[model samples]
Structures are given as C-alpha cells and as structure tokens.
Target: MNTDLMINRGIIKYNGNAFEEIDDVIANEYPLTIIVDGDEFATMVCTPDHLDELVIGFLASEGIIRAIEDIAALSINEDRGFAYVELVQKQTMSKDFFSKRFIGSCCGKSRQFYLHNDVKTAKTFMKQIEISVSQCFNLMTKMQEQSTAFQLTGGLHNASLCTKDQVLLSRSDIGRHNALDKIYGYCLKNKLSITDMMIAFSGRISSEVLLKVSKIGVGIVLSKSAPTTLAVNLANDLGITAIGFVRGQSLNVYSHPERIVS
Candidate 1:
C-alpha cells in the first residue's frame, strides 16, 4: 500500500516571502486498534506501515510483553486497521488503562503520568562502551540518511538503534515515539542486545521519550533536537546518556556524559 497521500497545497518555505501552490505528499495517518486477548488495548493513529512491529513495540513499552516469544499469537490487518495479539502468559492491566497514550502528529506525546508498570519495567542501564563525538555525529547522520520516508513526506520521525560505528536497525513514523518503538521491537525480535546500543532520533527528547529509552534499556540516545528538564533528570537517574541538538558540529550531553569521549 502506498502510504503517501499526494495532495495540492499552498505552502511557504522557511525564510520565504510568499506561498506557492504545489502538489505535496503527506504521510498517511491511519488509526490502528490493537486488540489484546480479545480486549481493545489502544487505537494508535500512525503511519500505516510496520503494523506488527508497532504493535509489538507498543506492548513492550507498556510493560505488557518482554520478548517476541511472549506473544502466542499475533495478526495485523492493515486494511481494517486492527492488530490482534494473544500473550503467552496471562495479562493484567490497571483499570486506568484508558490513560495510556494516543500520541504525535497523532496526539503528540505519551501519557504524562508515570505508571507503576513503567517503574517495574523501566531499567537503569549500565555503563556502555565509550562513544566518541565523531561517532555520535556519524550515527545521527546515518540514521537521518536512512530515513527515506521523512525525506519524501517531510512528515515522519526517524529512530534507530546503533552501535558506536553504525545503525543496526532504523524505523520512521508519523509519531516519533512509534518510530522508536518499531526499532525496539526490531531489536527484540532479532535478539539484539539493547544495553550497549544507543538510539538516534529525529525528535525532541521529552519525558515520554526518555521513558521509552529507559524501557528500551539503551544507555545512550542521540538526537538532532532538545531534551526536557524532566527527561534530563530521568536520564541522570537511570544512568543513561542523553545527547541532543546534534546538528553540524556541536551537541549537548544532558546526562551521564562519562560514556562519551572526545
């Protein structure tokens, strides 16, 4: 399915004086309702691609499932926009499950409250191998370069899990968190180690983003954006290195800067 919807638009460019009419391709927004064990879990408005990965990663982020093996059955119907999942173990969720997120160009952020499940599942990542300044720059560049969708629609967020040298897996979505989730699911499904890896993101690092990073158990995150105060504090508490504003030649390291060198 072609997820880009081309439409006519009159838009202005950055530092431009006038608007011009042109054909524009916008990333399609689809509502996908995830049903877990016959129960409606969440309805995520997202780019209609990688539904399976999105579902898996969402569940994991919510502290519902840990590994791909934890899912006994899973099916996605993109046309109807539904994901049916059966967990291997009996599942339980708080009564306030409705408080869960419906976040980005979508709702735009995860739930503000830190739930008990998040506390139980979110890990304080251990020390990782040193990442140099140049390595961080290279990783962000590589992640952005791989974001073909963002380049096309200029409407998607990109995320990647990377070793110091290169990106291991990358994903992009209308929602920044969703893109990160896809990368998380990819790493889990591939049995890749999360602790030593870093995430390269194309969005601001908020508390929600930091929580996702904590849950994903990555020690370092690099973004060509900024981080919130709460997120920086959380990163410090969790022993995670949060780097942001990774443009051209300089970057800001928010917390746990020991893991970065040069």
Candidate 2:
C-alpha cells in the first residue's frame, strides 16, 4: 500500500468494556472523472493511487480501446482528480451507451446483462489453463500476503494477476471493480496477454467481475469469497473457470471444474 493511499485519523476503540481513543489509518476514497475528447465519459470512485492504471483499465473493460495506440493524448490532474484523454480515432458513442456506462461504473453496483460493447468485445475462452488444487490454495495465500492495503485499512478489495504457478501483480482499491481495473489497466498499458493468466481476488465474484475477466481474456478467476449465482452461470457460458472459497486447503470450483486437476 502506498502511503499516499491512506491517512491517520483519531478513532475510538471498545475492547472488554473499555473505551479508548486511538489513531487509525483509513483508505482514501478518490473520485476521478474521466473526460474523453472534452466530454465526460464517467466518474470512478476508487483508491487514490494508480489513477493512470485505473483510467486505462476502466476504458479497456468498457470496450473503448483495445491497445495503447488507440490513445493519442492522455493526462491526469491528480490534484483536481480528472483524467483527460484523446483517442487516436474519436469514438462515437450513443447517448444510451454513455448513460448505461455512467450508472454501472461503481464498485457496489453493476448491470446484470452485457453492455453493447461487451457483447462485441467479451471473449469466449475454449482453451483450458490447468492448475492443481494445491496451486489454487497457494495462489490465494500469496494474494492475501500481498494485499497490504487491505491489511492497513481493512476497507479495500485486492485483485491479482497470476499464472498457474505464481502471482505476478497485485492491486488494491476501495472498490472491487477498481481493484480489478487497476490490474487490468496495467496489463493493457504494458501489452501483457491475460489469456493464459488468472485473477486472484479478495472480493466476491459477481457477474460484473466475471464479465470483466471475460473481457480481459482471463481463463480463470480465483477468489477467497463466494460467487454469485449469475456469475457462476456467466463463467460457465464464457468458458471461464470460476473458483471461490479459496482459503486454507479447501476450495470450491463453482464452474469449469475440468480446469482444476487433482
């Protein structure tokens, strides 16, 4: 966790019927407005750090751009919390599309069905990435260990990009969508392929999260928490392996159990 992402605040603690005043740190919630071609695309509420990654991931997931070359001009005003972007080819989005995106941009909220762009961009993975049961458990352990922001504020969700054998990158944010966006954006900016990779998450798997993995071309998604019924269904439909309850030695392969060997 970056020091800029958290702040110390005075708080009260009640333990064993005793009240005490203490200082505590809390994660900073930042709302960054994304302006594209001088028009507001959407506003994302997330952790203060990784503004660039957050913007990139959000745009990529929303089917705005497939590669970094699509962006012509990009600048972030962190002090004012705004990201201005100009695409190489200006995209003409319908009013309906922008409305849907604005409403569904937050972490706690999501649209059950795919957006128009999602239908065009969402991937179906027929390829399988094999992982053992032990590997899944170990990966979850590694993700937890790297979730420093969660340990600090206890108010953030973590998202990690990993292979069958090792965790590669981990990002945390106050919003589940933002956390995944951070990692997803990094991959996009760096030109990394996620088709052979997976995501280890600290939050529950929702349809939104599952769809994100699908868009990112990740074959597998592992989470410490449970998966929603809709998420499991979508994962099965998209040919993705959705695993949950990945704690300790036991785990549940909600969909695509075939990918989990041993």
Please name the candidate that would achieve the greatest lDDT relative to the true structure.
2
Per-residue alpha-carbon lDDT of model 2 for 162-245, expressed as tens digits?
998899998888889888888878998899977678889999999889988887788899999999987987787788999999
Q: Give the per-residue Cα lDDT of candidate 1 at 46.
A: 83
Highest TM-score against the true fold, candidate: 2
lDDT of 2: 0.85
Estimated TM-score for each candidate? 0.86, 0.92
Candidate 1 clashing pairs?
104-108
TM-score of 1: 0.86
- After superposition, candidate 1 runs with Cα above 4 Å error: 1-21, 95-113
lDDT tens readout by residue for model 1, 122-190:
788876578999999999999888887778788888889898998888887888889878877877777
